[model samples]
Target: MTEVDLHMHTTASDGMNRPSENVRMALEAGLSAIAITDHDTVAGYVEAAQAGQTLGITVVPGVEISTVAEGQDIHILGYYIDVNDERLLERLRQLRSTRENRNAMLLERLRELGLDITIEEVIEQAGKSASGDETIGRPHIASVLVSKGYVASVHEAFDRYLGKGGAAYVNPPRVSPFEAVDWIHEAGGAAVVAHPGLYQADELVERIVRHGADGIEAFHSDHTPEDESRYAEMAARLQVLVTAGSDFHGERNGHELHAPIGSRRIGAHVLEQLKARAK
Candidate 1:
C-alpha cells in the first residue's frame, strides 16, 4: 500500500518527538509519505524533509493553522506549502508572539489563583521535556501542572482550566479561515480542514468548502468509522480531496509515537489533487 499520513506534529510545537525522530518512527512503521504539520510553524519541515529523504520517505511540507469559527477553535492543514514564504513566516511570527503573551497571562492567572506556578517554572518544565527546538505550548504548561499534582491529566487541565472559556482561557489572535487558506495558497500549498467533526457543525463544512478549502481530513484518529464515511461522502459531493492522518503528538498524548501511521489512508487520486493545487 502507498501509505500517506498528512497530519502530524513534532517538538517544533507540543509533540514529544523531534522532526528527525518522527521521520524515523514513520519509516519504522512502513509509511511511504508523511507531513510535519506543526502548529503555526514550518520551522521543522526542512529538517523533516531532509530526514525523510535520507530514509527514502516522502516528506510533504505542511502546517496546521489555528482558526476560529462560531467561537470554536478550528484547525486548517496546509500541504506542500513553501516553507520559505516570507509572508507566511511573518504572520506565523506574529502568531507566536500572541501565543507567548497569552501564555504569560495564563501563568499570571494561575499564580493569582494560588497555583504556585511561575513563568520560570513553566519555562523550565518546557525546556526539560522538549524534544528538539520545539516551542513550548500549553501542553507543556499542563504537563507541568500534572507533574506538580495540580491536574490528573492534560485533558483534565484543559477542561477545568486552560481550555476555551475555562478559568485561565485567553483567546489568542488568529487568522480567519479565508485568510488561512489564502496564506497557504500564497505559500504554494493546498489547504484542508483538519478534523471537521471535532467542533464544527455539519453546515460549517459546506461553508468552509465555499471559503476555498480544497480538501477535508476525512480519515483521522479522532473520527469514528461513521464520521469517516460522512466526511468522505461530503468530500465527494463537494468535489474536494479527502486526506487522512494520525494527528500524532508523541508521548505527550499518552499514545505511542506515530501510532497508526499511514492507517488513515488518502487515495492516490486525492494526493494528485492536492499536489496539483499546491502547484
Candidate 2:
C-alpha cells in the first residue's frame, strides 16, 4: 500500500514551501515517496533528496518543464532526471529567460489595467533567494492579486487576470510539449503529461502519449472522478503507464491549493512503470 505523489512544488518554483520543508511535509503525511517537480529548474531536488535520505522517505529527482502548444500552457513532468545534464540546463535556462520577459509584460499589462503591482512584489511574495533566480510564474502573480483584494482567490485571479485569456495573460515563445518529451528523454528521465484535465484537449494529450510520453497524470488533486476514470481508460487503451500527483503548491491564506501533499496519490509501483517506458 506504499504511495507516491509524483508532482509537488516548492520555493524553487511557485510553491510556498522550501525544498526541505516539502520533504518534511511529505513525511508527516506518511508518503512513502514523492517528487520535487519544480518548474524549469532542478534547484530544489538536491535539498529535497538530502532531506529525504535523512528521513528515509524516497525522493524522486524531477522537474516540471513549462511548454506551450496551440496557444495553451502545458507542463511536462520529468522523473529520475540526471539533474546535471548540460542539455537540460541549457534548454531550461532559455525557457526561464522567456518567462522573465513574459512576467514583465504581464505586470505591465496589469498596470495598464490600473492594477498597482510590481515584479519585486511578486518576487518577494514568491520568497526570493540570494541567487534571485527563483522561477516567478502566474501563480505567484495570482497570490499577489489575492493579497491585494484584487481577486477573491488564486483560482479567480487566474480566471480574471493571470490565466489564459485573462486580462494580463501573456504567453511568450517556449518549447512545445513534444520537444519537452525528448528533452526529458535526453536528460535520462521519463516525461509525463501533467494534468490533462486542465487542458480540455484530450486529442492533444492522446497524441503526446502516443508520441512517446511515458504516461499521463490520470489522478490529480483538481481532477474529478470522471477525469481520473477517463484518462485511466485512455492510458489503458494506449497501453501506457498511468500516474497520479497532488500538484500541491502549498497553502495561501489558509487555503491549500490543489489539495495537500498526499491528497491524490498512486501506488509506488508506477515509478517502475515510468522508468521502464522511458528512453
Candidate 3:
C-alpha cells in the first residue's frame, strides 16, 4: 500500500532533525506522505512542504497544539492548516509564552529537587538541533539531564524527573482541548486527538470527540496493540476518522526518541480523508 505517517516532528520543535532533513528522510523511507506536526509551530511544516515539493513526497501542513483537560496533557494535531493564518499565529505566540512560564516553573522545581541544571544549558542543547523558530521544550531538558549524567537517557530522564508525575514534573495553565479544536477548525484544518492512549482518560477523550474533534490518532509508535484496537473501535463507533502516525521525533545518541518515520503508517489515501474534512 502507498504509505503515510501523519504525525512527526523536526528541530523546529523538539525533534532532532531539521525540517528539510525530515522531508529528505521521508523520501528515503519510501513514504508517500507525512505531516510536520511540530509542537505549537508550523514553520517546520512550511519548510518540509517546500522540501517535499522538490523531493516528490507529500508534506502535509500540520501543527501539534498542546492542551490540558482533567489535569492531563493532551495534544490536538491539526492537518492541512493555514500556516500563514494571522489568528493562528497569534494564538501560537500566546501558547509559546505560556510554555515559557511553564519552563521557568519546571526549572525552579528541578532546582529544588537538587539538580544542577539551568536554562542556558537547556537553550544550548536545543540550539544543537534547532534553526528557525524552534520551540524549546522538556526534551531539551532531558538532553541536559543526559549530558550532565543525571540520567542515562531521555526516557530515563522522563521516567525520573520530567514526565507527568515525576519528581520535577510541572503543568502550568494552558488552553483546553475544546478550544484547540475550535482553533484548528477556524484555521481550516482537521483536528485530531494525538496519542489518546498516553493520556489514559477515556472519558476525556470521548468528551473531546463530542466537542468536535475531526479525527483520533489510533495508531502511534508508543501505543500497545490494545491501545490501537481500543481507539480504532472508538473511532469507528463515533463515526470519526481513524489516523495512524509514527510521532517521529528523531534520535538521541543513535537511539530513536519515538519511532522511525513510517514505523506506524496508514494508507496514503487517509491523507485525502483528512483533507476532505479540512475542506
Best by TM-score: 3
TM-score of each: 0.91, 0.96, 0.97
Model 1 alpha-carbon miss at residue 279, Å: 5.0
lDDT of each: 0.81, 0.89, 0.89
Candidate 2 minimal-lDDT segment of 10 residues? 125-134
Residue-wise lDDT of candidate 1 within 111-216, one digit each (tens)? 7777777767777766543233345678888888888888888888888788886788777656677788888988899999999878658798778877889999
Clashes of each: 1, 0, 0
Give model 1's clash tally: 1
lDDT of 2 by residue, 218-272 (tens): 9998888999999999989998788999999998766677879998889999888
**What overall lDDT, based on C-alpha atoms, would model 3 receive against the true structure?**
0.89
Residue lDDT tens for model 3, 1-279:
899999999988889998899888888899988899999988677678889889999988999999888888999999998999999998998888788788888889889988988888888888853333568899888888888988888899889898987999888889999999999999999999999999989889999998899899999999999999999999999999999999999897556888999899999888888889984
Q: Is candidate 1 or candidate 3 better by TM-score?
A: 3
Runs off by more than 4 Å, candidate 3: 128-132
Global lDDT of model 1? 0.81
